[model samples]
Target: VLRLYHAKNVYYRIMRQNVLLLERKPEIPPSKRAHTGKVAVGESNQRWCFDGFEFSCDNGEKLRVTFTLDCCDREAIDWAASTGGYDNSTVQDVMLRSVEKRFGDRLPDTPVQWLTDNGSAYTAHETRKFARELNLEPCTTAVSSPQSNGMAERFVKTMKEYYIAFMPKPEVRTALRNLAAAFTHHNENHPHS
Candidate 1:
């Protein structure tokens, strides 16, 4: 048995010669926006992304804002704010309604797809049931890989940054209004295209 094993010994070797190991994925790494690979954004309008954010209120309460983004043109196709939907079912409901309003024409036939992180809300039963009911396909990213849905992540980051830095953080209603105003400005004048 020892003699036979000795005869079959072969050391492991690198596979590709053109793309060297040292040349792959640089040491400093690119930003999440740069690292994001091609999604079939131009193939169809069915692809979507989702993320949630918390807005600080004056009364020590928080309002949760959830948004759905279309991968193409990188626009916020749907968004909802709630004082109660800190869970998956509520989040899914708002998202579904947004999609339904915009593309209700497709209804049962359109192959809608959504991408998100492994948030508990993303895995809720109501969300699962709704996706099946609407014939939507759901894809989740790796635990640490937020870049898979980097567009959505980027939007959320922008919202938090601008909303806090520019808008006057006042009472609940004023803050909400400011946020809405900011989003409108972002959508209309930012020229992200």
Candidate 2:
């Protein structure tokens, strides 16, 4: 009644060849709609988004930064800095703290309707549990589409362009901090629309 394709099967080999020639891969019918990014139509911050970006230290080491932002005002609600030792815990902690900072005693009632992303970090069981504990919804973006998480992606691009890209790599954390401080001033004070 059904056919299965294993590694050594002719069907599998043919499928692999087709995949190599095709730029896009297949998805489940249920996920087909997300491929068009129709899930969170017209959503923005407080309805949050999260992502991790990698950076290189001057010591030739790597670091990861996890950040969360409100979809409405585009404000960075929280962030955490970690090196090669990065994991889901850091992201959960920072996000929870951010929500707490924003809503305080009302944190429980805060409607964080969406934590939108395509990042694996945003899909982790721990991440989901944290969001569930706080009553937030988890949403994934269309596969291979960065535009689904455009706001957070754009913020990252701006930070790298103005701070990281021009700096002397990652050994400049204090300088990076200063740049971030300046950026916060400009981001909140400059009246971006």
Report backbone clashes per prediction: 0, 7
Model 2, position 6: C-alpha lDDT score: 50
TM-score of 2: 0.70
Best by TM-score: 1
Tens-digit lDDT track for model 2 on 83-174?
65447788778778877877785564645765456566677888888888877776777675767777678778876776666756546465
Error of 1 at 2 (Å): 33
Q: Highest lDDT, which number? A: 1
Tell me the whole-model lDDT of each prediction, alpha carbons only. Answer: 0.70, 0.66
Mark the 10 consecutive residues where model 2 has the least summed lDDT.
32-41
For candidate 2, the per-residue lDDT at 135 reads 73
lDDT of 2: 0.66
Off by over 4 Å in 2: 1-46, 108-110, 168-172
Clashing pairs in 1: none
RMSD to true structure for each model, in Å: 10.4, 8.4
Candidate 1 lDDT over residue span 1-193, tens digit each:
9876665442112323434335456466444432244444884466777888887776666778888777776667667777775677666776777667667756646766777777888867778677767776777766667677777878888888865567876676777788778777777876457
